[model samples]
Target: MSNEFNDEFVKEIPDHVRQRLDQTYEKIRFQSKKKKKHNIWMRMTAAACCLLIVGIASTSEPVKAAISGIFKFNDSGIEQAVNAGFAEETDQSATNENVRITLDSYFSDYNKIGFSFQLLFEDPTLLSGKVEWISLDVRLKNGDGEYIVEFIPDTKPLYGKSDYSVGVHVMNPIIEQKTGIAQFDTVFDSTEGNFPALSNAVIEVESINVQYANGEFKKIDGEWNLPLNKAAKPFEVVEYVARESDKIKIVKANGNPTSLSLTISIDGEPTETPFAIMKVVDEQGIEYEAGSTNMTVKKGYTLISTTFPISSFVHAEKLQLIVGNEEVELTKTND
Candidate 1:
């Protein structure tokens, strides 16, 4: 019985049982302590990272606020006014807006001629924004009834810088032709034309009226005039006869002539006068006539040479004769 009880007790208590229990307890305690340390380190690291992020966020806020403030207050009210003014100036739909006029040219017959102009505008700003549309009623006058010209912008969503160009045409009744003469006489006659044979014509231009932003119209006064002259007539010819008896001779030769003897007179004086012959030419050749001779009278005269030969004529039909700085054309007579 005693041996059986001892064997049962030994079987219940296996070898190394106590040692295994002790090692298991030690591992559990070490693991618990390690877990606690790891949790504490994680909390500390998270707190430090949060502090760094918050510090960066706090330091950057003031710079953003300062930049925003500079943009808000630095620009003067002038920029605002200018922007508004420009918007108002370009707004074609706006009533009583300021208009711009660029003068190109002026005509006198109650008509604006070659007049080109543009509306002006200023830069846009945060205060004034942009212009949308503008309208203006312009009147041009010169103590006569007012001539009207309107301007409107053609753009949509009116914004930024903008301007418009307007053209005006003026017409008057004084410059119109008379239709009565054409109906009365259809035949073409140089002396009885329907148009006025005016020697000279004059035109005048006066003032321009501009409407401002306040719906008030202002007068910009100016004057322009144009004078026109008639065209010249074609040239004509006159004749004079020479009465001298002395013979004329060409002494020197210079250039070719169209006629042998020129029937030209100097200051209405006949060719018989002892004029200083500068150049003479016949139909075939040119010769300079020089001699000491006197004139009987300052009236019409003829030239005949008793000493010089007549065969040296430069031209036969017409003669260009120069006497005492005066030039005249001489035609040969058949007689």
Candidate 2:
């Protein structure tokens, strides 16, 4: 069985693709300590990285057909929202220092905003060889000169930081397979609370730094402030009777129909934090899980909230919350 499994799967992966995967893993391992929590890194590897490798390596016709023509580097939640007409189609472009940055599109909800961007280089050979990583300094502001979001580091795992206005966490940018064009998505989530009704918000791109496999670096220094329209849509909230266990209590759930995202918040007296809730299964036993999660303990109460990109669970006849070894039933309020 082991020989057959590897002969069919492992040997099919191209040497170059394998090397790329190894490099990406090493990079993530090196950056994991400084940039992200260990759990977040684990989730990324499990969902994104693993799937990416398999999608690239798999020779099956069905697998190729499944992944073909999709933007390989997008958050599933935001992508679904965009598909459901919950995003702004902004084809705006600004060129600086030989690099053309285009804000291809964006989606915004109560607590987060995501951008899909493309970087085109005049020198087509800019991505000639192994590209290590690409980093962008992005900022968003409202008309009143107030910063809409800013990335914060080392916010506590349980109780989030309260002093900051909006602590935004920027996950690493992903590059598409095409040459001379680096298409990627970046999501900025508010750690403090939900975002306000924004108007006249403009995304500012200060600079972009790219590192190649040769250890040489290329930097683009300039500012591009592109106008953004529309305020974020409020999340659809559903109230529950608040069920409780010894350590955790289920409060309410927030959902977005367009994005197919669900956020479950649990509040109870602080005790041992439950293990990560990785997957959610509905009555039919179909599973879905995607999106970011965080917990907060405020005012002597612990609050754990996680968002998942499950479209069906919003209206599922029966839904269950699975965290660690604890499985709690979720009953919705009557319509």
Candidate 3:
């Protein structure tokens, strides 16, 4: 792993890490005027940060736990998703000059989608720490090369030790050697977006703008495409009581065996916001976290779909949902 830390220049952290943290922080800082309707997770975020800093001083274990807590998914989480039938994973590559970009694979559901890529440079030195994206864009195109749905990507660099692991985990970056390639990951919503629904479409890379460490700017552009399809299969949502008036139903389970989750739709009175699902524990005592979730305000109910990844495929059954302020156990039985 690359032990490199940006000790002098603070430019070490890629922008998305800071940007998203700020966005999530500001989001909960001023969520609602009424104390009753206050977001539980957002309210706890600050304390979590404090705990993280304190943990860093005490032990690395707590720091690691705190850092991993930033997102609902991790490497193991991705493995679980793959086991659960992670949609159509397509690979394609494009090259310009000495730089070659390969579209690796992707994960998706009806409401959300995520994909990763490996950028390979013939001359690795050309890639620098100072590089900045002028813009990173992705969109869906048709057979005749027509624009369909434009995905406003939320981007991140997975390979380097950056602020995401540091600020959140408060640890050094997990750097591997400078292999010939660098991994880049990004995700965007499907339903809430203004763009039309993505059905049988090709996911393509529009452009990537970069500013090098030495002040040189480069924009690697391409039309790298991957075939994407909706992969979540609807299941008979088990009606489980979360609160006095609220009920949660496991709606759909994506079929990817390596990576899978039981989708849930929670409905109740207007006062209901949504449950803050902390973890999903199995019969074997393995606890999994919520990976990706989507919610919409319909005429009658707030339809929410949450995907929880168990440790593995065999560990997916006989599960319990750890949700809300009071952790309610929602069960999934083979019967």
TM-score for all models, in order of appearance? 0.16, 0.64, 0.51
The full ranking of all candidates by TM-score, starting with the best, is 2, 3, 1
Tell me how candidate 3 scores on lDDT.
0.40
Q: RMSDs, each prediction?
A: 50.8, 8.5, 11.6
The digit string of per-residue lDDT tens for model 2 on 85-195 reads 666666677888787887766766654566766676677577666665555656667677666553211221212222222222222233433335565455554432255
Tens digit of lDDT per residue, candidate 3, span 1-335? 11122244223334544353343233212111232222223211221231111111122232123122211223354444555555344446667656555555555443334555555557645543533322234555544455543433234211211111011112122111243344454443222112233456576666654434355556566655555544333222222222222465545444233234444555543465556455666666766655434344555555544444333345344455666653445444443
The digit string of per-residue lDDT tens for model 1 on 1-335 reads: 00011232112212233233222222211011211111111111111111100000111222112111110111121112122221111111111122122222221111011121222222112102111111122222222222222111122122212111111111110110111000000000010001122233322223333222233333433433323232212111122232332243232221111112122222333433344444444344444342212122233433222111122122235554555555544454443
Candidate 2 stretches greater than 4 Å from native: 1-76, 151-179, 190-193, 230-242, 257-272, 276-279, 289-291, 312-314
Best by TM-score: 2
Q: Rank the candidates by lDDT, best first.
A: 2, 3, 1
Which candidate comes out best when scored by lDDT?
A: 2
Model 2: lDDT equals: 0.49
lDDT of 1: 0.22
Q: Higher lDDT: candidate 1 or 3? A: 3
